[model samples]
Target: MQAGSPNTRQSSSPASKGGSARRRTPRSRNRAPQSPSAPKPSLFDQVGVTAVDPAPFDQLGLPKALVGELTKAGLTEAFPIQAATIPDALAGSDVLGRARTGSGKTLAFGLPMLADLHGTSARPLHPRALVLVPTRELATQVTDSLKPMAKALGLYVREIVGGMSFARQADMLRRGVDLVVATPGRLNDHVRQGTCVLSAVERTALDEADQMADMGFLPQIRELLNHVPAGGQRLLFSATLDGDVDRLVREYMSDPVVHSLTPSAASVDSMDHHQLDIAAEDKHDVLARIAARDGRTILFVRTKHNADRLTRKLRSVGVHAGALHGGKAQNARTRILEEFRRGSTTALVATNVAARGIHVDDVSLVVHVEPPADPKDYLHRAGRTARAGATGTVVTLVTDDQRRAFRAMAGKAGVKPTATKVSPQGANLARLTGAREPSGVAVVEPKAETNRNPGSGGTRRGNPRGRTGAPRNGGGPRGEAKRGEAKRGARRA
Candidate 1:
C-alpha cells in the first residue's frame, strides 16, 4: 500500500483488529480498482482567474491622457502581462506579477501607479509612488520608459541611484518629485540622510524582485518597504518567486492577487541555445570571429576584469567593442550603452550587470565566455538577446574541463542545447554567428593627452620648454630655489 494512503491508515486503526481485517472476500479484492483522477492545474496555470485576452489599451480603462501618450508612442495593444495585471492594478489591488524580462512589465506597473497619482498632490521630499529596481541601469531604463507618460499626467518623475551625484538627487527630492524610481541602496542612503521620505507614498512596486533577492538586497528591500505606510498598495514582479521573495510577500503584501504570464522557470521560446566545445587555445579566435560579424553581440564574462580584458582583445582585432561593468563610472557606462544602441559599438563585453536591465534593440547574438554560476543568471544573460519577439542565438563555449559543469548548468536551466565540437575555423561557427574574418590590423588606442586636451598633444603653453614641449614640474633650478627661499624665510620669521 502507498504510504499515507487512506486505506493503509484505516487498516491500522483499532476497529480493523476485531477480525474485520480478515473478513475481506476474494471477490471484493479481485474487483477492478478505480482509476486516479487527473491532477489539477497549478495556480499559475489557472489563467481563467485573472488572465484577460489581449486587447487594446483602451479596454483596460487607462486614463485618456495616458492612452494618448501610449498611442503617440505607437503602442496600441497590450502585452499579456499588461493585459493580465493592469485592470487589477488600476483597481487598487495589491498585485504579484510573474513574467520574464522584456515583457512590458515597466508599463504593467507604471501606468496604474501614474493613473492613481494623477492629480494627487505630492509633498516636498515625499513621492506618492516608488519603483525600486536592483541596478542603476534598470532605474534609468524604467525612468525613460515612464517619463513620457508621467509628463502627460503632469507628474514629475526622478531617478535616485548610486554612482551619480547625490546632491543632485537631494535637490530633486527637495524640489518635490511625484514619483521616484531608485535602486534600494541609493534610496536607503537618501532615507538615512533624511533627504527623502516615504510616508506620503501610496503605491510601491518592485521590479525583478528575484534578482534583488539573489543579489542579497532583500534586507535593504525590506527596510525600504517598511518606510511606506503599512496600508499602501504594494506590487511585486519577478521572473521567479521563492526564498526571500516569499518572505517579502508574507511580511509586506496583504492578500495580493498573483498573476503569472509564463511558468516560473520558463525559457524564452525565441532564443536558440547552443553549446560549442572548442580547444582552450582557439577560444579567443573563435570569439573574435563571431564578434566581428555584421550585427550586434553581447559577450558575458565572469568578472569585471575579464570584461575589460576581452573588450580590449576584441578591439585589438579591429572589432568595435565596449566594456560594461560596475567598475565604470555612471556617465561612461551610459555612453557605452548609448553607443551600443546607436550601432557605433556593435559588440559589448559585460559582466552580469547588463544581464537584467540593459535592453537594446536587435541584439543578434549573446556569447557566454564563462557559464553562469546559477540557472537564473543564465536566463538573464540569455535574455539580453531574443527580446520581445525577436529571434536570436545564445552560444556557450565549453572547454573540455568545463563541459561537465556546463552540462549541469544547462540542465538546471531547463535548456536542451545543440552541442557540437567546433574549431576556430569550423563552418558551424561561421554559420552560427554569421561569422566574418576580423581585420588583421590592430586598432590604434588614442593617446590620453589627446583625449584630455583635444588638440594639445601632451603639451601646454605654461610649460617652460614652450608650447610644443612637455610640461615641467618646476620651472627650473631658479624656480626651485625661489620655493626653497620662501620656506626658509617663513621658518626664520
Candidate 2:
C-alpha cells in the first residue's frame, strides 16, 4: 500500500519526474535521443529481463464496471502477469500464478474476485472472498487494490490485520463484509475467537504464498484455512511454488491451472544496477546526496535503528527522508508512507516491510544502504523500482568490510554491477541523480571503537565495538528482523 486509499487519485502519482500513467509511454517519444556517452546496461541489465506481454484486460473478459474503474484509475493496459492469469481466474478456475514482485499480481486475482463476488446485502454479511497475504503492508495494499471494484459492485471489504483494534474488526464483521483482505495471523485470531467466519467464503487467494511459507506463517495459514470449507475456490499466486507452498497446492487446491510468467529473481530489464566502492567514511554522504535527488528514492537499511538514524540524519542535512519498518505503529507507517507518496517526503528509508506486495509507482531509484542477505531479497528490494516497463536505478553501497558479503549477494542475485567510486559531491553523481548542486551533508567515517559505555552490550576484544546498529527508530536493519519476530508478526499475517 502506498499509504492511502485507492479513492485518493492524487496519491496515484509519484513525486518523481516520471509523469502519470498516461503521460508515461506517449511522452517517451518526445524525449531527446540518448547520447553515445550515456551509460549502457551492465550485466545486471539482463538479470531480471524477460519479454512481458502487455495486453488490455478486455482480452480477459473483466466486467465493464471493473474495466471502467481501472481506466478511470489510469491503468489502461493489463500488466504481463495480469494478462496471463486474469482469464483463468475470471473463469472461476483455481489459478496458480507465478510472477515476480512489481509485476502487478494484485489485480491478477483481485479483478476476478470482485467480478465474481455478490454484494454484502446479497451474500448475507460474512466474507464471500478472502485474500491472505504475508505482511500487514501487503494486506493493506491488496485491500487498496480491491476497494474501488468492491465499491463499484456495492460490496464491502475490510482489512483485518494486527496493531488495529480487534473489536473494531469484529464490529465491521458484525455489520457485514463481502471480501476480507488479511494477514493470516490476525485472521486466524479472528477465526479462533469466532469474531469472523470464513464458512461463507467462495473465493480464497493466497497472495505471495511463497513468502507466507518463508516467513513461517504456514501454520497460521493452515489454521486459518481450517475455518473455511475445503471446496471453495482457491487461487495461489507466488514467485515460486515449493516446500510447504507446493504442499498447499497438493492439499488445499483442486485441479488448478498454473501460470508462471517469470523466474524467481527476475529483476526488471530496464533497471540499471551500480555498485559503488566507497570507504566507510564517505558512504553516508553519497547516500544523502542520492536521496536528495529529484525523483522518488527508496533506501534500504540493514537495521531498524539505522533506518531511523539515517532518516534523522538525512532530514538534518535537508533531505526529506522518511523511515518505514515493522516496529512502527500502524498509523505511523501509514503516515510515513503517505508522506512519501504525496511528495512531501521524497525519500523513503525502509526494511523488507516495504519490499513485497507494496506498490508505489515511479520509484525511480532503489538504493541498498546496506547489502541484502540473498538474491531473493536483492530482487525484492530492486523490484521496488523499474516497474511497468519504466526505467529505474538500483545502487548498492558497499564498504571495504562488507565487500565479501556484497559479492556473495551479487552472485546470489545473479547481477554483476559495475564497480565505481562516487565522489561525495560530483558531477557524475549529479548527472545520474538529476540534481545540480551538491547536498549539504558531509561525509563522515565510522567512529573508532571506544569504551563509550561499559554497560552497552559490551564489545568483544577485537571485533566491532557496538552491537549491529538497529534500523532507524530503534529497529534493526530493514531485512534484519529475527526469524522469530517475523514469525510473531506472521501471527498478524
Candidate 3:
C-alpha cells in the first residue's frame, strides 16, 4: 500500500478481513518447477467490476483477530479500491489495480495478503510474502501499516532497504520473517549476497510499479520475482498501467483482476489550482511570505540544492522549515519528516522524492517553487495535497519565460488554473496563499541528529568490518591468497 491519503488510510481495509492459508516450503530460486495448478492466461486481459460498494471489515474473509485490530484502529470499512479488489484478491486471483496515492491501496492488498500468510510460517531467510516498493520511505510506511494487522494474525514482517543496517536486516531474515518489505536495489543486493531468499514467496505485491519502471528498476524487479514460483498470487498496484507495467502484467501476472479508481493522469478535483506570474527577483520574497503562512505547507523545488537553499532562506526569516531530498542520509530524512509530522516544522521544502508516500493531515497548501516539466510530474506534486476529500490549494510559481510551457503542461493535466501576476507583499499573493511578511529574525536550523550505532547507514563505528560486512581483504579465495602473500613477505623481511 502507498499509504494513499490520510482519510483513506483511516477508512480502507479488508471487508471480510484476512485469514491464514496453507503453507509450502520450496528451496532454490527458480529451481523448483512452478505448480501445475497456476492459471495461465492466453491473452493479456483485465476484468473490471463497476458494482463495487464499500463493505464492513468483518464480512470480507479476514481472520477474526485481524478484523479486531482494524476496528481498534478505527478502520472498519473498505474504501473504493479495497472494496473493488479485496474479494478477488482473497480468492487467490492475480490483481492489477490503478489508483492515485492516498486512495488507501495499502490495506487493500495488505489485509488480504496477511490473511493468506497467517497460517504459513517462513523458513529462515525466506519470507512467505514479498512487497517491492520504489523508495525506502514508502517501504517504511507500508511496513508500519501492516504491522498491527500482521501481529493479530501472528505473523512477522520486516523491511529491507538502503540507508539502514545491511547486517542487521540479514540477521533478522536469518532468524525468520513472514513478510518482507523492500526496495528493488537493496533487496537485490541482499539476494545476491545470500542474505535473503525469495523461493518461498507464495504471494508478491508490487506497489508503485509505474514509478519503479520510471526509475529503471524493471530488470532488478524481474530478477527478484523470478525467484518466486509460478502460479503464486501476485498483485500489482500502480498509478498508471503503461509500457513497462503492462509488460510486467503480461509476462508475470496470470489473468488479473483490474480495479481503477480514477482515470489515467487524473488530477485531484478538490485542489484549488493557481499560477502566479512572478519575476525571478520577486520569487524569493513571495516564497518567504508563503512559507510564513498558517498551517502546514509543502513547497516543491527541482533540485536538492534548491531545497536546501530555500530552507535556509525561510529559516533565516524565522520560519521553521525543513529540507528533504534523496541526497540526505536516511536518518536525516527520517528526522526531517518526523519533525514536519509533529508540527515542530510547519514548512517542508523538498524535491520530487516527497511527492509519493508522504501522507500527513491538514497539509492545506502545496506550492510548486519550480514547476514540473511534465503533466505526470505536475499531477504527482499536486497529489501531495487535496487528498481524501479535503480541499487544498496548489500554486505554481511561473516566470515569464516558463509561462507558455507551464500552461501547456497544465492543460495536458486537465487543469485550467487561475492565473495572476503578483509581487512581494501584494494583496493578490496575500489573498491567494494567506501570505504575510515573515518575522525577519534568523532561527538557527537544527542540525541533523547523529546515530552512534555501527550500521544505521549514516555513520560507522570502530570496527574492522564496515557497512557491507565484508572482510578486510574481501573474505574469499582472493583474500586467502593475499594473506599467504603477506606471510611470505614477512618471512623475507
Please give me the total number of clashing residue pairs in predicted model 2.
Answer: 29
Give the top-scoring candidate (lDDT). Answer: 3
Tens-digit lDDT track for model 2 on 1-493?
0111113212221122111111101122323467789853211122232334667765557667888888889988988777766665655556666776777888888887777764336343377789999888888888887898888878887898865656567668878888899887767766766667788887889998877888778988887776776667788887766668866766676545556566665655668888877778877788877888887999998777888889878877778788887655566677778878888888899988888667888899898988888777788789888876678988888788888888877887778787777677767666656543435664342222221122121111221222333322233233223322553555533
Q: All candidates: CA RMSD in angstroms? A: 16.3, 14.3, 10.0
Q: Name the weakest run of 10 consecutive residues (lDDT summed) in model 2.
A: 17-26
Clashes of each: 0, 29, 12
**TM-scores, in order shown?**
0.81, 0.78, 0.83
Q: How many backbone collisions does model 3 have?
A: 12
Q: Per-residue lDDT tens digits of candidate 1, residues 134-207?
A: 88888999999999999999999989876565666777888899999988876786787777999988889999
TM-score leaderboard ranking: 3, 1, 2
Q: What overall lDDT, based on C-alpha atoms, would model 1 receive against the true structure?
A: 0.75
Best of the candidates, TM-score: 3
Candidate 1: segments with Cα more than 4 A from true spot: 1-51, 446-493
lDDT of each: 0.75, 0.69, 0.76
Which scores higher on lDDT, 2 or 3? 3
